[model samples]
Target: MGKKKFHKIFISMLSFILIFSFLQPSQASANEGLKINADAAILVEAETGKVLYAKNPDKVLGVASMTKMMTEYLVLEAIKEKKIKWDQTYEVSEYVYKVSQDRNLSNVPLKIGEKYTVRELFEAMTIYSANGATIALAEKVAGSEVEFVKLMNKKAKELGLKGYKFVNSSGLNNKDLKGMHPSNSGPEDENVMSARSTAKLAYELIQTFPELLEITSTPKKIFREGTDDQIKMDNWNWMLPSLVFAYEGMDGLKTGTTDFAGFCFTGTAKKKGMRLISVVMNATDENGKGTYNSRFIETKKLLDFGFNQFELKEIFPKNYEVKGHKTVSVVKGKEKEVKVHSKEPFKMVVKSTDHEKYSPKFQPNTELLNDKKQIVAPIKKGETVGYLAVQAKERESLGYLTKEEANKARVEVVTTQSVEKANWFILALRGIGGFFGDVWSSIVSTVKSWF
Candidate 1:
């Protein structure tokens, strides 16, 4: 064969191999082999807000009681902002009175003239998914549910939530125009939200009110304890331990069901010090296993996938102590080097089985003092010299992330002790020693040449 023809044939074969290699599946994050029977679904890590898994995540649909999550967010904001108090009592309006006792809805047994503390109502709303309780809390925050829903829509905008709209504080669709929001144009007005928006709201909700897990993580709670009106309420999320669909590390969020929004769940779980939020919308009533409530089943799938697929690699343990190679050198100071301590733990999330494929780079020694050329003396004790940042790189097929987008954690690097400037006498001695060291080297080189 001619030399040119031989080269052409070789290049063709090499190109095919390269293309075929690229087509091979990446084991870092697998999307197949797990079937999620939901219209829209998403899974995200709380710390990084990194989306791990998604399926038609942005499609908009009615979210039913999941609207209560936003209602809970606003109510908590009101309490923290001192707009209301936990001990304060709210008069049970006729709206709440009727709605709470509605046989068609999930509600608390409420008396028309009876008053309840803010804490009681809040718990009833979150723990039991009480429509009237959430509406009551909404009314407490705003003048009425109509006004409260405006706040919800405003907050949604602030969160950059698109393809979603809130028509009511509770997720109920109103059949009467009197019960409709100002934005409602027709009788049927159900709150609409995409799974992505719902997940984003869940993420922000947890970040803002971390204490919410205390209320939501409970398997069961009793309102009006030790009273005639006492009603023991159980959580709708069966993911809690000892439940029919119990799962370890499963805590909360909310569940929803309606003719339009069939069996939806926005759930959170914490395992191995890592927290993840998963949202499954419009899940079928059956998993084809004769097991009803497919929302919880699919949620378990997502959460299990998240926990099993990712591992938290702790670069520095929480409340870390300075020891070993975790130290940075100090120049021209009283001490030649000082131990570096992390102000907070640094961790990176990576594929559980692909830890070896990542290369984490932490900089404090290198990037100290705004990438300082030299850290001079007179550094104060507990002074922030630099920051420790950790990044992990691995391969994944996520289009949102680059080929090596790694999880990052950062914390300040502080000086353990003051580093005073070296005295003039010490500087002079070092200069003399350095001068003699150079002279000795020159003499030694000359003597060896003579030999």
Candidate 2:
């Protein structure tokens, strides 16, 4: 080939390769223009469990009072298990009352020996962010704050939260004032959690105790012992507008702030069967007013992107038949043929442009029974024998097994007989004699009737 032609061909091939590579999807380009705090952030679809966005989500950070989400989760579990009654009165212990007495502490101000019901304590802890109320409720439910912290850690591990540690029911920093430790081993600087774990914990709490919103979403509540005496408290979340907006589905969740943790919030909103959880941590005050507009605005942007950009589509309805499996052999069965069907629906979300690209694939067990076309004796209906998976182009959405339909298999039996040659003539003679005897008896009976 000429040198000029060779050079042109090589350049064209290289151009094609570069174009194809650029056309392929990359994570960085897919997430462009979404802004977040430098510390950590995550956005997730609660129903589909799809991670819509994440930024340093796994990085560990002090979560401050967001720890109360887990505390509230355990409390709901206790209620569901009937371990404590909603109206059960608990006497305020001296320890809890002393903690409440801290002027700096956000508390419900339970006096020593005074009693309050579990419901009142939960409202104060979850709505008012009352530290003393949380500790009291933890001790009342788990016998001690130490035991409750253990429960929180166990639940965290169970939920696969790897970057979390709990030293107390309330997420109070225990930094030493003198900046000196006896051995640097006592509590190991007990910081609470990360944005990913905090969002997950909030989601679980809402699912477990949806009734919490009935208290948290209220703009104000007045707790009073008598007609004239009352203490009124207002909600900390400012996103909930007094007048409903397009995002009226917004509901109750927790907010946190500390000098180290700097204005964090976990917010949940739902619309049209879809729910989303958004978290932001370590947001700097954008206006230099020590306000949390950074957290609020960034969270609003992420939530708006999620709610506006995507939707859930049922690619496959539950129990919808995909295709039949090849016949399998059954041992000790009559007729041979068994069909496989799906046990549940398959579904996924796709861009409105990509919905037509979805398809399903069936995978079945090829091992045949003795009969080679049917299942073995006593094969029950609705038993899963294979799986069906739905996909969007190359991405798989959901996979589940196909089951047998009702009364699809039956038993078949066979029998055979043979006569020896020597008995053949005797059998023929006896057959002719019996035929003549039957004719003679019929004639005699007819004659007797006539007489």
Candidate 3:
């Protein structure tokens, strides 16, 4: 074979290999321990908002003090908007004092005459699940618990948390009234929320108020202002300071337990460059006891499965070209060939184990024009004439258009240079001569038919 023919064959082979390499599919690694005994659970990546695992995640089950996440979200928004100052003193309201006095419920032990900073109350409520502190801060910020609940619902809607309801800042169950009061009022209402909604709310809280971690992660905090005796609240999260593999980047979210709601917890943990939010609700002890340790165990299992199974890999760099379109023909253009280029890069998430096997596909749309196939005189640059598309394993991903060149100027028919060259006039005169010749041929053919 001639040298030029061998070179052409080698180039064709290389092009085929490149095209095959860009048309492979990516796969995810298999995950273990996906089964957990909570009524509903979800594990999601905080940065990309990708769900790693979910089991009945959207089921609307009661989520106890996890409701405090909404309360915390509003508080942070208030602080960010300058509506509430962290160090400002707030007088303990009558309702807050009454709730604090109740030994059956969680309390920061606020006194009737004493004052506490908004930051301290927030710490108690978020770290210790202090019901009284939650209500006190709500009233201080919104002037009433009812208004705070309204704000919570409004924010929930704004966050696109569907199927969520908040009757109070605290997730306490409302009293059921079988009979009407003397004033003939209607039956009492109740507060409720779902595990999925709880997780979304907590995720938003951590994203908005990262400073809340300083309080939530603290295993112990002591309040020394209200009563003769100091009140110390230990963080209820058992996984924070107890477990051997307990993640370091873990922080305060909330835990909830009631006879009706069972054990519930929304946990947020971050490590390296990844953050995960897990929610477990309706977990019960082997003996049917409502406790949070069960929820914690399930959450840990989900997080472990996520960290062990998959890893994020960037397949392509930003603005990297994947492929280019074939040369296209344009009529009356100075440029003979126009090549199309991609405007953006192509990428895909693949399993670490499957990195060698996965491949990407690039497809560019090229169409043949009906005009001149050779260099002409009228094409302009950067004018869009056609488009190109990219695909992965036959699946179309993105598409963009090809532009014309700007440097190629149009050729005028009647210029002084063209007249001087004589070649332009010769070609124009030949075109006119050919037109007259065709007309004369047609007349002769008609006369021959009559003969």
Candidate 4:
């Protein structure tokens, strides 16, 4: 064969192999073989918000009682900000009392003209999915459920949640609110969000207040214990370690169910120093009917896929420097260039087989650079010069719950040593040397062209 033709054929074959490698399925995508059996589902790493698996992730659907997770988050914020106290009591409103009396809804009966403390009501709402308790806490925080729904929407925006709308504090259909739905929504409107948004909410809640696990992990509790108003409250999260569908590392979260919302769950579990959050919306049985257990079954499949197929792998160690990107040019400094390295190790939860697929995407701090893309003198040791972001070398990415999280999936690049300004004499000498070098290079190039 001719040399030119042989080289062309070899290059063509190489191009095909490179393209084929990227087209192959990633370990997380391989979960496609594992059916989730839900309308919308997502699994993410709690620490990094890395999405390990998804099914119809962006499809908006009724959240049912899972709306209480927002209520829970707001109440916790209220307590933290001193807007409300846990021991503070609220008198039962007629609306709350009427809602509590309904047997069709999950609730702890609240007598007319009676009062309940914030802690008592919060427990009832979170553990038992009590709609009345949820409303009661909502009122305590915002003075009324109507106003609380506004706060829910406001906070959802603040948290960067997308594809979400809160019609009521509880996830109950607005029709079940007895004509007392939030003024901004229709009477039949039920709180709804996409699986991805739901997971993001859960991620924010856990990261902000990890102590919530203490209450959510509770299997059973007595509301108003040893009182005439006392009621036995059992947590609806069957996947808790103490519950029937107990899975190792399973902990606190929320569950929701309504005729309109069907069955939904937001669950989290920590095992082997890694935590995962999973959201399953409108889970159904083989017959295509929503069942109480179907949510847990679907959640189990997601969590199992995460724990079994993925693991925390440190792709880059602390202080590691990227090839061809280890140094930043300095202007008027003792050193012409300063070495930079990552502030922390880059760790991610990914399948072992996929570790090689990710590479460092270095982003220099443009603000710190001048016209020549060089830093001004006197750079301090450990000073941030840029960021080292992780990017999939190919098109296949496990993804993240939020774009913000994706942007933040990076480590700081800092200077290795302080750089002092060069002495005036040295600077002058360097300038003279550079002028001579440039003149010499120009004359040499002109002579070579003539030759």
Write candidate 4's Cα lDDT for 1-451 as tens digits.
Answer: 9755565566557545533442232545556678888898888899887888878888999998889899999999999999999899999998899899997889999987887889989989988999988898988899888899999999999999889999899898898888777788898677889998999999999999999999999999988989888888888888888778999999879998887878889999998778999988889977888898999998898888888888888889999998888998999999999999999998887785888999887766655755355789988999888878666887764466776776567789999999999999999999999999999999999999998
Best by lDDT: 4
- Give, for candidate 1, the lowest lDDT window spanning 10 residues: 398-407
Badly placed stretches (over 4 Å) of model 2 are 1-26, 175-188, 225-229, 243-246, 285-290, 324-335, 363-377, 394-451
lDDT of 1 by residue, 268-341 (tens): 99988899889998886444331336888899889898898887666565545444335556667767666656
Evaluation by TM-score, superior candidate among 1 and 4? 4
* Candidate 4: worst-modelled 10 consecutive residues by lDDT: 18-27
Per-model C-alpha lDDT, please?
Answer: 0.75, 0.63, 0.61, 0.85
Candidate 4 TM-score, true structure as reference: 0.90
Q: Once all C-alphas are superposed, what RMSD does model 2 give against the true structure?
A: 17.5
Q: How far in Å is the alpha carbon of 430 misplaced in model 4?
A: 2.0
TM-score attained by model 1: 0.72
Please, what are the lDDT tens digits per residue for candidate 3 over residues 24-80? 111121224367777877765554344566666667877767888888889889999
Better of 2 and 3 by TM-score: 2
Candidate 1 regions exceeding 4 Å error are 1-30, 157-163, 176-186, 221-232, 285-292, 316-342, 362-387, 390-408, 414-451
**Which sequence of candidate numbers ranks them by lDDT, best first?**
4, 1, 2, 3
lDDT of 2 by residue, 54-140 (tens): 777778998877788888889889999999989998888776777766647566678776778899888888777777788888888
**Lowest summed-lDDT stretch of 10 residues in model 2?**
399-408
Q: What is the lDDT of candidate 1?
A: 0.75
Ranking by TM-score: 4, 2, 1, 3
The deviation in Å at residue 249 for candidate 3 is 3.4
